[model samples]
Target chain A: MSLRRRDFLKLTAAGPVAFAAAATLPTSAHASPAPDNAFDDAYGVLVDTTFCIGCRKCEWGCNEANDVPRRARTEFDDKSVTTVHRRPDATAYTVVNQIAAPPETPQPVYAKVQCMHCNHPACASACIVGALRKQPEGPVTYDAWKCIGCRYCMVACPFQIPGYEYAKALQPRVMKCGFCAERIIKEGRKPACVENCPNEALTFGRRRELRSLAHQKAVASPGRYLDHLYGETEVGGTSWLYLTGVDFARADLPPLGSRPVPELTEKIQHGVFKNFVPPLALFGLLGLVMASQHSGENGGK
Target chain B: MSPTFRRLAWGIVVLSALHAPALRAQKVQTEAEQRSHMEMMKLDCRQCHTCESPTTTTPCLMACPRLTVAQSSGKHVVSEAPESMVLDKLADQYQGVQFDHKLHAGMAEMNTSCSTCHHFCPPGKIPACVSCHSIEANEQNLRQPSLKGAYHRQCMNCHREWSHDTDCNVCHLPVGKYAQAHDKTDPTDIMGKAHPVVVAPKMKSYVTPYAKGPVVTFYHEEHIELFGLRCVDCHQKENCSYCHDLSKPQAQKKTMEQVHSLCSSCHQNAKCSKCHDTVERPAFSHASTGWSVGRFHSRLECRACHPTGKRISKVNRDCTSCHGGWNQSNFRHAVTGLQLDETHASAECADCHENRHYNLKPTCAGCHDDKRDFKAVPPGKYVTVSRKR
Candidate 1:
């Protein structure tokens, strides 16, 4: 009797509404107010693979800038590492892979790979505790404080980015390129990799301008380029774009359809969790049945 | 002036003014001027300037054209260019680059001349890289690389060939660390250093994919010393990667056109057997033809007599071995400086000498029983009256 029927009904009705509001909070709190796939003003990078000489100078600069375990600048002269292709891992946020090119190419094409920084990141969508986030300016960031070691974002990324620190006995971070978000957003400077590139292979600018620049590059040199800008329309677009001389797959970038990965799963799967509505409805039905039984027992008595 | 005269004068002025610029634009260049301009390349001005009238101030220039005519390099000589230049325009983190201009220009003679580095330069003057490649990259014109990028691309195109070592210390010393080193002895340090002699291989034997006689022996020394061919004449547009690539296999895949391009420049009409033979061909020798270019002909170039091409020395040949047109009547004695006497001139030709053996001195045993002292007493008096020979 102390748990009154009116109070319980009110609680059930109000709970789901509050939960729905909280579930939608992350997008408004962190992401750009712009509609999906339209981050025209957001920062972006254009990677021209043809200009990369596999110098590894950018890698040295990045490691030093990010406060990772770094070697002397002169040690980057060991270009033998370029002979073997590599992907970004926990230690390094960005890596340049010397991939096979057409036989006519004088040197093998080098691919600089990092997080694509997707416009609508599936990693952020899949993050259960809201640790992973897509910032308004262009970076898809991660907060270790809220991560809870779920590793769901790892499975969610289309680029196969976001490596985890399994070796650490204590707290391990879900590591990936931060897009030098602090430097870019706060200091208004270029990313260390872009600044250090000898050939200016990595050009940074507004995402919209970069798309046009990539298009112009292909158009200007029709023979030099493949006429396609990867990450432009792939997976609803990305902050990082690539102008490749060869096929995108040859550069280690998988050909993804325009429709985002999260679009397939979010509506149904996330809809169930968005509000406490489904659980509340299920319990409300059960509550109604139990109450009816109790009232029937009282009449029988 | 009459009214009609005034009208005609106005019309003439207007017509000339309208056609003035058009005439200049379509002015036919001379053979020399056209030669300097690579035969007036890029006739369509739109390739360089986007607009109709590109002004000096606004020059709405596109980036350096893709097919930048390197032919203008002929206008530049090593003496006319700067000896050395300290490029400090954009130097910030590192010290200014000590570019050995004369050294590089000297090296350019072996490559495509000054155009090897200075790919685009208009007539009359050579503008510095900063003239076209501005401080920042032209966002509109992605074709022109930024100043920093331009400098790096020019240097690294060759240095990058090392594959392992594009070590910045080779060119860029830490600012304070290097400036003092150069201050001590500025002239001699890398700034004014000359290009080291490129030690070329004596010969290169190519086992080509040709079905008929595959070995193509190129005698590098013979081509240089005997044939008198300059390095640039043959090694045009040589690829640095072709020499520096360490990972590539021994037998690189060159197309048939590419493999033959170097030899075809001089050996255009040469038979395949001249180059491609079962065994390496011996160095060319005039002695093999029973004419040793020994003492008198040693200084003569092969082309002095041979003249190259399909017709081998048929016309414009220097030697005087054949005088088929010469006869007793047409022959002039004073020119040879032994004017014949009346009796000697009246005698039948070949009475004392063979028909074609006029170079030989003959005996006078046929007419006068005396010594054949033609120079002193027998023939005619010398024209100049001195025993010069």
Candidate 2:
């Protein structure tokens, strides 16, 4: 009878062990489906740098949408404003830097640098406070209340975007280009930057659609541009992709490979941590043996 | 002695013996000792360090006897140092142009060299300036840039002098103060180069009040008309900082009055007609202007609401942009801290209070005109109404 009882316990332990093994496997055969999320919507943008004239209309739209503070002690109507090239600030959520090309065939390339809203956002993983999170609708967004203002997200970000408000003494916030996550993802509309771009330089759509459009634009313009689509496979995939007429190297953008940043780090972490399962199984077996041994000892007494 | 002690002694003896020769040779190096001993032979300095013009023959390879051997033997001598032969040929063929080594070295310090002006001809050949200059203006090297590109790249790139004219005549003039002897055909233009605004003009500064240092002499006048900066071009309140809050004295004290004066001086006068269409001359007469400084609050443009030409004028200051006939329905009362509490006697007046006009019933009689028989409860007269839901 004791041997039979031991067999039953063994079966119970084997069942869980098999299940845990399957869980660690690459295929998610028995795993639960991914949670329904707005980010699952998979929206993106096609930024053709060739078309951008650096008009700064999208900048104004972003400022209006996000309520960012203006910096230069002058009004927007002042023409001398565009002379000084601008970068993304706490108030200006998005900025377009003017990159001057060669003199003879001098064409000014305006590169719009903003949040890439990565598919597997490193910012989301780095945020221990859960302030920065990848929303279900495919946009990495910020929750102001949850942020402790550690600014870890800024450092972890490969793009080195995401600015902090130094002046606001009482309640400062981590300001960044959220793909207008609040308006677009929540309200089901295009981002203010995309909608406000006068030259139609910024196009909003899905990641799949953006890839094809970027490819078509690149192929159509021969010798006019570097035949490469930035961000299609960079840092494992970004919602925002760019097509430029000049070499991207000149723009100081990194040559990121296809592997998602978080996956590489998480893979190593899990490899070390997955020892949990074997230890857990041993514990289960030990518990069963101890319980049976104790029961037999009691009966004999 | 023990074995360990004997081993230690042997180790010390061996170390001393091994280092004895080096220790004997060690001595402080005198300045005379540092001088090149090759001076005893009086060999030409240019033998190793060849300096040559960037013409057909590189400065280093000029009159170099080893160059022939180097070429035949297939040993590589890659350098731009002027060759003694090239210098001799230049002295004979070309006039004595005091090739200022000091100036050229100074220019080279600011502007990078070594690989820029010269190249090692592959298959063991010396690269010359003419090698690059031989290729005519094409897609690769735009037509405007000539061999003068080398000269200009040196001049314009290393030009730390910002106060003077950056024209070619400043440095390379045939008759100018720094002009060398007899290459009157303008050696500055050697390789047929044209200067195309070599150095970018320094930008003008715009004056700002808050700036602690020199006033930012912003070149507004040039950029506006020339760059076609439109009315809405830079009015971007997002990119600039120039607002002043005069309501709170302590907070307002630190605020520069120049911010108000400079901004209002330009903005008030720029397009006043666009804001105030109600009156022709913006009525100087106080009574003719039906607009009250303390009434009719709205998020109207500054020019629209503040019609008075005076520096300071009283205007309704409130968070009633929506309530004052401007149907900003998107605006939330909750944003202004105006959430109503129970008892309906107004939970906190100052919390939602503003200097702007609002149709809030100031007294109980205002709302309950007939219910309270048009009588208002005076100050200190407390009234409470409780209803069980």
Candidate 3:
């Protein structure tokens, strides 16, 4: 009985050890089926901060377009709102924040904070049930019906852009700037904020061309703009880009690296569950050991 | 191909055609050369005219000249420009801007000329802003600013430097509603605001920071009236923002170095006391130096007698200092209202001018026994001459 017990322990330990080793190998049997979203001709917006007048009309336009509650037209004229820095919230999809500049300069820097609509959004990667999807057409779209209300997406967003409808007791959903995806992708119209801009500071075009345009503008007017383009490679490049006169850090725009956010987590998770081979091997060995042990016991009887 | 792709190709051809002149610009007249010729006439009729004289009816207009964008302004005086212009092309939400055309053109003359705003034009013509900049932004060409952007950029470039006011009401009155209810009789209701005509100061006195001497008096008119300094000689260094910056309502205090920089070109080697004093100094006078610059000398420029260098050397009280070269042959004594007789004509200058002191009256007692004065019994007959005080 002691010898049989030792044999059972050896078999069980060896099975798991072999299974663990197999998981480390790159699996050909269970290749990921996630759609390739590295699109080249995706639409984007180029924001020239040098031209922005900080009118806050873009905020009003965003509210009107996204079905968010809007105030009277005159409300946007109240520039005192810029006295305090603001963030995009559940009620509003975009907010223009006034950055402090040298008092002598006539042009004041304003940053329009919104969802970056990253090519590889961490929010979509964090969503366990696929409620948030990085659409091939260049938007991280959310489906409220499919959402389990896990709220992981909110925590995972690098820009802290995702907002949860915590006020709603039922049918609460995650909200963010959808980049006016329906208008841009389907109807082929400019985003409401871009259309409403009096200065035409926001330019909507192809991502590749805009990238070149942003660089060209910076190079052409070296004194007017800093060399840095904020979203060119941040989290593998966002659909929206910024051209700022001030330093990116001073403009409230953080510099993130070129690596995609999903690359690391996908590798680790995909490795463990690849082909379900690890679980199968461990269970198959356990059943065989128990049957052999039972037959030995019967013989002993 | 898609319609959009075809349109892009067409746009490329159009843009290339617009800039085609730039490629063959070797034979084109340089801007400075054009300006030199244009300076002779206020209006650049020469750009279009093949003949020297262009009449009202027969301008003698040449074939359209090959002109570059830069040399096209051919800037003229403010009088040639319209006093005011009504810009109504893009006026949708606001009233047409009643732009004081002459006022802006006048200001531009102080620094850059018409080329500052009139960036694009034919060789002789001053085209409207709408001529080149399209109503809609050119999607195919990113360099070309739309009409709206061009208008705002031109105004805001300089206005923002001084006023820093991007408010719509600054330039445009609202079109509809209570906004159009302007009072016609009210003085403030006048459209096309004008800069108050600047009255040049005669003099300016300041109590400066110098410990030894505080008061500094500047003779503003005398520099131009007496010294013959043009306004551009000193005014060229400073820009409009020096006085017009609204954010800084009060003019800034300057350091000694900063103050001297403005006057350094002329007063490079001047002493501190030359400008600064414990009390405000009076305007300069030759009388104070014990030598009166008489009517004839007063008409002459200060540089004519004084050394035109770092320091102005004083004229010696003795007449010989400047008139040393003058002798019997060159003196031409007839200028003194006396035509010398045969006897005195051959006499040495010292015979009448004792000790060569020409300031003193001539002494006749040296030759004549009878006591005769030069005023009564003259050496020669008096001739009518323009020898008046």
Candidate 4:
């Protein structure tokens, strides 16, 4: 009776092991669908930090357009808020932080922070249920319906942009800059912050064109801008680009390599489970050994 | 037969000898012909040519001095140049901006002159933007902007002040589409229209939140027209958003010290009551300040009497305050609108008046007791009252 029980347990375990091996086969066979090419013609914004005057008009415009409850108009003009470095949160999708310039520079520089909208987003890869997707038009969109209240995207973002609505227990969503995707794609308008910029500090156009323009500006005015165009190559390029007079590190930007974050994770995953043969063969051998043991027990009986 | 051949050979020899000198002279003339006609007029080649014996190949003429010479004295009238100019040096992505040369020149007459735009012009013609600014990015000299940057900076500097619009489409259209889109009217034609007169405000009042002095009245027109001050004189570094942005709150709270700096040059800010008052202050009048800048002093620049680096109101208003030791000998008596006659020209200033106040009517009692009433005799006929003073 014991021998029979052992045989039944081995057979039942083999069924689940075979199923697990087959699940990873398709993913290992093909690479993440060759990162969608839809973002090729997508638009981008070039933020020339030197030109920003720290007026906080972009903050006001964003609040009005996005329907984010805000203080009085007079409160926005209070520039004392820039004394401390602030980040995008549940309430605000974008925030402008003032970076104090060195004594050699004329004035302090203001940098607007928001989602970078990476070309190959790690956030989309981290989502277990396909809740997050990088849109063809350069916006990384999130579907609240598909989300299972997992904050995986928050952890995956290199810029640390995604904010979670922790206060809402019923239906929480990840919040970040959507690049005004709906306004740009459907309404044929520039992003609210970009439109509100009085100084023309933020130039919105096709990503390729803006890249060339950023390079041209840097070349034209040496020393006025740093040699590197931020986001041009970092994290395999991003929709938003930046030009700064001082080092990007001083402006609170993180130094990152050109390789996308998803590339590293995907490469490791694919390498270990190439063709799913290793896991499948190991499980098959394990099941066969258990079956032999059960047959030996039966022979003893 | 031998004698006849000898005579013919002798004739040929004579003709050939004569033509040799003529051929040599023609060769020399051709060599000199290469020299410009102007070069021939200079009897002394050393004046321009550096070398002792200058030839066509090594004339070694002095480098042209026209560039330096033209900087100080070149005066090309606006009408002499083209009415409009198309700046297309860096027009790969955007259509070249149309510059209305005539209209800008006309408007420039108000404050600035032709040199405002023709900054590096030559003697007879306006130089192109590329003349001073290099078309390519010049790494060696980063102080000067490249041609594209230079053009944009020049246009946007002034355009940003008035229109406050920096949209690329405002000044630039897509390449190859501008001409077709503009159709009957060119960019220059639109730009050629005169800018609407920027009306100077007669008065402006600012109600500050300060407890000491909340209200500040600014005599804008008086400061501009009467004081002969330009718009940029006080409004230096003013951003357009200060006036154009309606969504923004009121001007940021400026410290009392910061507000004073703006008027420190002309007015004494120490006197808080001068600017800050409960009611609107009347337009500034010299008479109200105890000394009227009368007809004679009105034409003089404020700096002429006040001198720079000092407040205008702080300077002494008395005539003798500036003209230190005024008497008969050194003083040009006619400047006071009263030309001294032969009788009084040599007379001492103390002879006619008891008090030295020149503004007070002079009493002829000391010099001419008989003509005690000076109304009977004028000092002299005004010496054509030279307005040059």
Best by DockQ: 1
Error of 1 at B99 (Å): 3.8
Model 3: per-residue Cα lDDT over B1-389, one tens digit each: 99999999999999999888985473254444445556644346565678775544555754323232344444445686789988777777667787888878767756556667876545455767776678876666554567776687777667656755455666776666525543233366323567778777999998877889898899989888778775656666234565676565565787868888877777878888888899888898888888877756788877878866535676776878777887766777887779888788888888888878888888987788798888898888899887454
Q: Pick the winner on DockQ between candidates 2 and 3.
A: 3
Clashing pairs in 1: none
Regions of model 2 farther than 4 Å from truth:
A1-41, A70-74, A77-86, A272-275, A278-301, B1-389
Candidate 3 accuracy as TM-score: 0.64
Task: Count backbone overlaps in model 3.
Answer: 0
Q: What lDDT is obtained when candidate 4 is compared to the true structure? A: 0.70
After best superposition, candidate 4 residue B58: deviation in angstroms? 39
Show the lowest summed lDDT stretch of 10 residues, model 2 chain B: B238-247
Pick the winner on lDDT between candidates 1 and 4: 1
- lDDT winner, 3 or 4: 3
Candidate with the larger TM-score of 1 and 4? 1
Q: In model 3, what is the error at residue B360, expressed in angstroms?
A: 19
* Interface RMSD over true interface Cα atoms for each candidate: 4.2, 18.7, 5.0, 11.5
Listed per model in order, the count of residue pairs whose N, CA or C atoms clash below 3 Å is: 0, 36, 0, 0
Tens digits of per-residue lDDT for model 2 on B1-389?
A: 99999999999999999998775554222223223323332334344345532222233443323222221212333233442222111122222233343333322322332222332222235555445443222223221223333333333332312211223233433342224432244454322233232242334443433323334433444334333333334443211012222221243343544444544544565443322233222213234455443322222334454566433355564536434553323333343333233434342342223233344444343344444421243323334332222
lDDT of each candidate versus the true structure: 0.74, 0.53, 0.73, 0.70
Cα lDDT over the full model 3: 0.73
Tens digits of per-residue lDDT for model 4 on B23-93? 78866764574343234332345444567766556667544322222232334566787878887776775
In the order shown, the candidates' Cα RMSDs to the true structure are 9.6, 37.7, 11.9, 17.2
lDDT (10s digit) by residue, model 4, range A1-301: 2446767678667755555556556655754343333354798888888776666767767876873556554456567677689999877888889886785564557798888889988899899999888888888888889999789999999899988889888887888888888999999888998876655677777787777778877886787888888888777788888999987685558998776788757655554476986557667766776788779888988
Q: Compute the lDDT of residue B321 as modeled in candidate 4.
A: 84
